[model samples]
Target: MRRLPIRPFAVLATVGTLVLTGCGTETGDPGDRPSSAGADRTIRAHKVMQLTQTHEETGMTLLEGPVFDEDGRLLVVDVTAPEGKPKVMRVNVSDKTFRAVRTQGQAAYTSAQFSPYDGRLYLTDFAHGEIVSLAPDGSDPRTFFSGEIDGARMNPDDLAFDRKGNLYVSDSRGLREGEARGRVVRIGRDGRTVTVLAKNLAAPNGISFDEDYQGLWFSELTENRVSYLRLDGEGRVTSSHTAIRVDGGIAQTDSIAVDANGNLYQGLHGRPAMAVFNRNGERLATVELRGRTEGLESATNVAITPGGTKAYMTVSGPGGGFLYTFDALAKGIRQSNGG
Candidate 1:
């Protein structure tokens, strides 16, 4: 068995709050229905293509968190590298060219997102417990936030920002399970206040906001289940429910992404498959990975392009890590970068 650089047993500590903004806007309403529930509910499999062999070329494995940049380049983290080493790579989706996006020697980079407000990328450093900000071209790297929040150590993993600029992060706590150590936090746009939306999660690995921006969804990796939470006017979680529970098939789930139509995609780590869920949390389809190298052994993360035509996913195994691109049945929600 192969081990990823980021341990699955770590946890984080902290909670915060801030004044809610734009509560009644399109991105603020939590009343959107979850599923369209018609022909859109089922998605057929599409063509999957392996883009590059960077991991094999550089001996860098354990890839995670892929987000498309404004230029349509995908930025992913190579978590196996050490501190002070360059760990993020920008890949050109068209020509299959890639290069390291230089950062100021931050710790291991895990997940990254394009911030619409600053026109910058926010990345999660697994070793430093901080969020590092840098330009889309990977310049002017700086620590956006670090250290304890609300008196607890903040180990941010996968993160996403709401339209209002509030950041939500999953503190995997080394991917510990069922200990209540794992937590989800919302950071205010002001960059000071924090709010604990959900805690005691069993390895909350992947998180995303609904298309309506009214609800938040996350997957408990070890629990083999996905969950949904509705937020109140104050950005506090008002209600929660189990979205989907994988009773069989993939054992562990990692990162996830959602499309504009509320279709959810989750990477089934240790398996060559990705599961799709409708807005109502029903299992809609299962897209099995088909690659030249015996399929994707470990699908770590999934991201859809802004136009929603292609869905990019990261996979790793003993052989190496590879980026798999395929035509998506549904259109993904555009990120802050505009893809």
Candidate 2:
């Protein structure tokens, strides 16, 4: 991920206060009643793999983009790891073991997903402003999308693919309030033509196609909200609107996934939780960490298995990075794989 600029002094002061005093409280708009507000069902997630060293000595590690390959192996990215450290890892959930898959580059890979057309793994290299792809075994890395569009650089954060193999990316460039320089772009299946589907967004980060692929959903980090874009037969946006507004407290929204039933599992920072919402924006439930949140404040991304019976979340903070699992609310499909 691109380094975030420091906020204004007043906003920093307020965020500091919230961090100190609201550690145990649930975060959401008071006007919106979350199911967690009334004995809502809570899924306890346990750690499956540890991805980092102690932050005091090695700095913080950020884990994002939990995805599963056709072989059922889980893959994730370590965005904060420097050169020579593992940037991509493969984990076997059955035995709770993991191994470094690729570590030869200096790329800050923020998200990973398998292409339906090629079956290769594609990653969003946020630090390089490009999308790179490699074979399932982590070999033959090559640039898939790079350079600029309309004379502007792109900070590609996350991506999703359609049934026809077309790719959509979220260009999370501007982080400042009221700076709507962010956008969403699409790459045709031919791998040459690039189109800007939406622009003037506020740090559009997580992106995924909704059920039936008739629309798209993306999270605007700067605005702390999710927006939906109805797409035409040619994947052009016909209409768009804000679907959900989140009260992030001291944090912001991050990566997201969609279930077969069209429920959105949105990851959150500054807390170990995920807020679930139906396609219509109704609060369904808030999936919270099962244990201590002392150093696990960052729950940035989630991936559900094919059957949707189980889900995994990638979390990180000063305590390092970890993978947590919980029961999913609905059946999982291709859309729930990753973003």
Give the poorly placed runs of model 2, Cα more than 4 Å off.
1-41, 54-58, 176-178
Q: Each candidate's root-mean-square deviation in Å?
A: 8.7, 6.4
Each model's lDDT: 0.62, 0.74
Most accurate candidate by lDDT: 2
Residue clash pairs of candidate 2? none
My TM-score estimates for the predictions, one after another, are 0.80, 0.87
- Cα lDDT tens digits, model 1, 3-76, are 23323424222121111000000011112222445332322223232333323322334567788877777887
Candidate 2, 61: how far from true, in Å? 0.4
Question: Model 1, which residues run further than 4 Å from truth?
Answer: 1-60, 83-86, 103-106, 174-178, 248-250, 292-296, 335-339
lDDT of candidate model 1 versus the reference: 0.62
